[model samples]
Target: MKDKKPRVAIQGIRASFHEEAAFIHFGEDIQTIECSSFKQTFEALQNKEADYVVMAIENSIAGSILPNYSLMMSYNFPVVGEVYLPIQLHLLALPGVKFEDVKYVTSHPIAIRQCIDFFDEYPHLKVVESSDTAACAKRIREEELTDTVAIANTLAAKLYGLDIMERRIESNKKNFTRFLILTHHENVEKKDIDKASLCFQVSNQVGALAKVLQIFAEQNINMSKIQSMPVLGKRNEYNFYVDVEWDNTKQYDTAIRQVLKYTHNFNILGEYQRHEDEFVQNEREQKFRAQEKITRKYINVKKIVK
Candidate 1:
């Protein structure tokens, strides 16, 4: 008999970017449990419906996902790993439908915002917001709507048999989303760990927060991210969530031990391996991406009329 594939939970349907991240982190052979929202994905994990969860924590274009940060505080799930997915947005339409036939373009709010520059050039094309990017593509296929186009990934285009009306439509070509892999099972050993996510609160004193930061600095720990969230009922109190990376495990251990004395409600959310993205490797990867020169049908037309 064959071993069972790991069940992963994501915040969107198949062919969605969430699923793409899961496939990138885990193998393509895993089962995906589609979820409607970020909270539902965490609930699925708590209910034992999934072996792990892949959630978008931040994006280069959209910044932090605050609600998901609250969920992390509520559930306190262990983030065993992280995945970075390049957010490549494209316009997709039916096979026979041309650029002139598209009146309305729909996609997720964040995805639509990323393509604002593209849409600004065509003021006549009505931009509509939807729940999910892939869902918009799926709807057009299932409903056989020829007048609608979807801003989605290449996977959705291939899956729904839609033509790529426009390629690389996003405002920023280098934009990518960082996803955290939360799971109940952690197989990582102590010595192998070099990254950690921690949450704590400090006093209102002038140097209260600085004192803790100084500890990590002296120990040579790299603080990658630091975000603050207000306490629900408290006025001035806030929870500070920090992600730290270190080359030497002993330095991190010494830093964390010293940090405990300077903070309140200090919680180690999880300790896992850090995922670093390679910005440029070769000449082709470092080149500026030009969309106007691309072979899209709209490039030929001077202006798009509604």
Candidate 2:
């Protein structure tokens, strides 16, 4: 007997980019279950209906997705992996509809904001929010509204059989969304190329946050990103979420121990190997080379002056 494919849960419709990321992470052979909302997606995993869930936690244009962070604390799911997808917003509408005919636009709220410059040109056009980008495209196809358009991705337009009125409609060309691949199991093996995400709350004291960060500085751990979110049920309290890249050669153990010594509440969200994609790898390499060049130039100028 053949084994069944792993079932992954995604928070959106069939043509949603979350679905695309899921396929990219888990491969096409994996089965996918679509949920209408992030809550539903978490529930699907909790109920054992799906083996894993994929959800977007942040976007380059919009910053952190606070609701997902709250959900992460509420749920017991572990983030097993992460993937970044470039977001390209497209203006999609029914066939034969011209751009000038668009009187109303529909899309996820973030998508609407991402294309604010384009929408601002037509002050008379009404903007409506949908649950998701692909969901808006589906509505445009289902209702066959000639005057209404959906601002979504090109993939969504193709999947819903809608015509693209405009391509690359986003306000920024470098927009990207970062998603977390979550699972019920927390026992995944940590790899050598692992990045660790942690969340903690520092006591409300002077230099508390600084002292916590100083531990990483002493250990030479490079922090990739850090953000603070308000703590629920506690007035005037905030928790910090941090992502750090550490050397896996036992040196990280000292850093980890030092971090735990300073912070009160600490949770290791996940330590997983970063995704291997040409675009991301190339970007990292380019950044390192640029920094190296700057350092070498500084040293050369200092020597010349001396």
Candidate 3:
């Protein structure tokens, strides 16, 4: 019997950005489990309904998705990998639909925000926030809504047979979203591991946070990202989420050991090789497979379960 494809849970319908990121990381050989919300994506993992989950943690233009941070802390799942997908929002509608026919535009709230500049031009069009960008496109196709348009990715426009009324409608063309790939099992330590995500809380005192930064500098670790969220059920206390990249694993180990002394509720979320390295490895693998004449299949069309 042939081996079953791995099931990947993503917080949107197929052809969504999360699905795009999953395919970019895991290849199209895997099966996608569509989820309506981010919470449901994590729950699918916990329920063992999926082998992996792709979740958007942050977008360059809108900043962090704060609720995901809390979910990560609650679930304590290991982030095995990350993928950065450049967002290109397009105004999609039925083939015969024109700009004047678009009475309502729908998409995920964040996506709607990204296309604010385009919407500002046509103030007459009402904006509606939906649960997913691709879902909006799927709805338009399923319902054959000629008066409604969707701001979604090019993949969605293609999948749902919608025509792009306006291309690259996002306010910022460089917009990109960072998605963290999560798994239930502990990630195997790799020699090429260079990046780590961690969360911790420090006592509320002057210079307490600076002390941790000083330790990182002394150990020569590069602090790539830092975000703070209010600790639940605590007053004025914040939990820090940080991403650090290191040149030497031993240096990172030493810095984290010293950091633990000053930090409470410390957690190393994940230690994994950076996405750049993963891309390079995948390139090598693809080349090798090409030389060996191995065939790979891809799934371009998928059904909307809704």
Candidate 4:
């Protein structure tokens, strides 16, 4: 019998960066399902209509996507992997339309913000928000709005067959977005791995957070990312989401246990290897070498006993 291809759910229509992240993480063999909103994407996975969900977690320019962070805590899905993509915003319109003909522009809020400087120059242009950048492009194409432009990615422009009136319109050239690949199953094995993400809440006492962090410092564990979000159940209480490189040795287990001693709210979201093509693997390799040194020291003591 032939096995079914995995279906990955992502927020937004075709040509969305979320879909690109899904393709990067799962490859081309898998099927992709698009949802209009993040909630719908989560629901698709929760209902077992999709095998996995790819969601954007943060942007280099705008920082964390707060709503998605809250969604992460509320949802039952676990983040199994991550992907980072460089973002290049473009201004697109119908082929015959010139930049001067643009009277209004539409895009996702984040996209509009990224290109604020460009839009600001055109004081006559009205900026409107849409559900997504790709959706804005689709709307322009469907409505045949020659006077309206959309701020979107190059992929979106290509998908909708719109001409790029302006390219790389984002204020910053180093824009990037981080995405998480989530799954309902927890026991999924990770191969060729390096990074791991966990969620934990520390005691309210002073230095409690410091003590938890010191475990990683003492064990030489390298933390790549960390962000805090308020815990919904308790007033003013907060929890943190952290990403660390996975060392082949058992130091991760030790460090996690040490953090648990000071904080009761600890959850292992996922432990997977970094994407090979990115520089993340190089950073992980350095941490893995540090773990190797610790392993060698333990091995040398056993040799002395013999």
Best candidate, TM-score: 2
In order, how many clashes per candidate? 0, 0, 0, 2
Ranking by lDDT: 3, 1, 2, 4
Model 2 agreement with the true structure over 1-306: per-residue lDDT tens digits:
027888889988887889888878887787779898999999998998988889998899988898888788788577788998888888889999997787889989988888989877788999998888899899889988898998887778888899988899899987888888888864365556468788998888899889978888887787888989988789878989898877653666788888787787798887776675766787789999999999999999999999
- Write model 3 residue lDDT over 25-108, tens digit each, in one string: 988898999998889998999999988889999998888999999899888889888887888888999999988877999999
* Tens-digit lDDT string for candidate 4 (1-306): 027778889899888888877778877677889899999998998898998889998898988887887777778577778888878988899889988878889989988888878977888998888888888899999999988998888788888999998889999987878898888874366676667888888878889889988999887788888998888779868989888875644787788778889887788877776655545455458887998999999999999999
Residue pairs with clashing backbones, model 4: 193-273, 194-273
Cα deviation at 191, candidate 2, in Å, is 3.5
Instruction: Predict model 2's lDDT versus the native.
Output: 0.84
Error of 3 at 79 (Å): 0.7
Question: CA lDDT of 11 in candidate 3?
Answer: 95
Write down the RMSD of all candidates, one decimal each. 11.5, 2.2, 13.0, 6.2
Which residues of candidate 2, in runs, are more than 4 Å off?
276-279, 301-306
Which of 3 and 4 is ahead in lDDT? 3
TM-scores of the candidates are 0.89, 0.92, 0.87, 0.87
Candidate 3 RMSD to the real structure: 13.0
lDDT (C-alpha) at residue 22 in model 3: 92
lDDT of model number 3: 0.88
lDDT of each: 0.87, 0.84, 0.88, 0.83
Candidate 1 runs further than 4 Å off: 185-191, 280-306
